[model samples]
Target: MTQDPVSIEPLCLDEGHALGEFYPLKQQAQAEDFPADPAACRKDFLGQILHPRPGNSVLAWGARMGGRPVGLCAVGVPEAGRRWTADVVHFVVHPDVRRTGIGSRLLATATGHLAGLGVQKMTAFTSGPADGAGAGDAFAEATGAARILRYQRLSLRIGPTRLATDGDTGAGCELLHWRDDVPAEYRAAFAAMSSRLAAEEAARSGSDQVPEDFDEDKVQELYAVLRAWGYRTYLTAVRHRETGLLVGYSALGMADSHQRHASQWDTIVLPSHRGRGLGVVLKRANLSWTVEHEPELATVTTWNAIGNPAMLHVNESFGFRLDQSGARREWTL
Candidate 1:
């Protein structure tokens, strides 16, 4: 008997039927590192396919053998300014098919597609236990992707803690909290602060990439996309009482009311505001607010680059335990 040849094809997003075929492959691929939550995963899959973020688009392909999917790949490309860059958002081959060429073929297809679009760089991530290596790392290495950065994934169980203690936000600063949307009065300041932080991070990473021009309109569009993706966002920011400027902010997002886990999005303090404990203040405020609003939420997960010790310290202070160590790899095309 001869094995059936593997066939790779683009996923049909025009209808929901393809999900039945694609979901199983996703589950099998992530079973070891990330257990599947049927409802949540379905929502996320459909949301990204149907209502992607503004200025971004996703392309997915499924590899099938014997008329069933055995591997999958999804890539995301920014539709506008960052056309030269793309992300290999999801790449997996069924465990049973490991060591076979299916994974390589899927990656080759993705790389070809990206090259056709003039993408000059592509990045992917692999995650596993903090102390052990995983299949993803091995695959990336075998494919000759350069490991550019290491990240620590941390999780915090929601509970009563000292993080809720009121802290001084400087003598002339005040804290503001909001759910779902940024208040009209703070929109401009929030956009400016976010843009600045993005630029700083890009520079710190030794990338010459320019940060997106995040204006008030762009900020509103971001929140709208998050809403479409089934997330309820919680934000906390510190503002100068006299200047009326936002000095720092932190954000947490929960997928739905039933989700027991939430994701910590970003925590940033202006350079001038550093050492004033504003990062701690912003994160604590957001975490406390999220806990209050999300009655069933159990844990919050966050990722930080290993070199960012300051942010790691703040998370550790709030009792976030190490969950996984991961590598971010990149390929130049």
Candidate 2:
């Protein structure tokens, strides 16, 4: 018997039911390496689809065989700089449908749409070894994309203990802690510091991509999206006491009080503030705050580029263990 023809359709906010159908395929795709929390995963999936970050747009497509969703792909285009690039946010094909043309067709459709928008390149992330023969790795290679970077996922088990609070954070720097919003007095400096971090990362990666200039409005938009997904942001920043400028910051995010897992977001220290052990100070302070606030939290996970040894050392000192490996692949259009 001949197999039924697969159909690719656009997934939009109005089609919530159809979008939800992709959850099963998502679960199956990640089952081997990353067992997901059903409730949290579904909530996060729907939340991202329903409420995207401000100044960004997402395009999703679903593949159906005889009216059942068998494959899914979603791409994101930023509103500001880097308009020539796009991110392949999520891409998966059901196991039963392996080797079928569905995956390729879905990608082609996405690329065609993006090409029309004048996007010159696209990037994707795969959750496996860059050299391994996993399905995700194989697919990326088959698509002629280069594995540009590799990252290690680390997790730290939390306990009922208080982390050390005192540390050398430079001669005249003071630490500030806050939940959810940046205080009014620090908003402008915080935005500038974030923008600087973005530029440094892009330059370090040898990419000419332009960084987004963040402001008060952009920060609020980020918080709004996090709130829509039922997440709380915990931040720890170091301010130069005499200069009254933010020199470093670290942030952690929790989905809700009920979830036992949280994720470390970002940790950045200004170039001038390096070699003072500020990274350790910022991370320890933030983790202490996270543990104190969330009594049920068990594990906190983070991802670091394999090249960043300094941050890795800090995480290792905190007892974080390796969980898995992943790679980022980029394709030029």
Which candidate comes out best when scored by TM-score?
A: 1
What CA RMSD would you report for each candidate? 2.4, 2.6
Candidate 2 deviant stretches above 4 angstroms: 36-40, 80-82, 129-134, 161-171, 256-258
Q: What lDDT score goes with residue 219 in model 2?
A: 79
Q: Estimate each model's TM-score.
A: 0.91, 0.90
Please, what are the lDDT tens digits per residue for candidate 1 over residues 1-333? 677889999887677678566766666666655663223355555566556666778888889999878888888788865787777766878887778899999988888888888888788879877788778988889988887768898998887664466566879999898999898778888998888867765655644445656888878888888888778899999988888888899998887534688889888998888987888888887877777787777788898887789999999987898988888778777
Question: How do the residues 1-333 of candidate 2 rate in per-residue lDDT, one tens digit apiece?
Answer: 788889998887587787888887876866744554223366566667677776778889999999988998888787655568788767889888888878889989988888878888788878764244467777888988777777788888886553656465767899899898788778888888888877765655644556557887777787778878677789999999998899989999987534688899889988888877899889888888877787777888888887788888989987888876777787777
TM-score quality measure for candidate 2: 0.90
What value does the lDDT take at residue 57 in candidate 1?
88
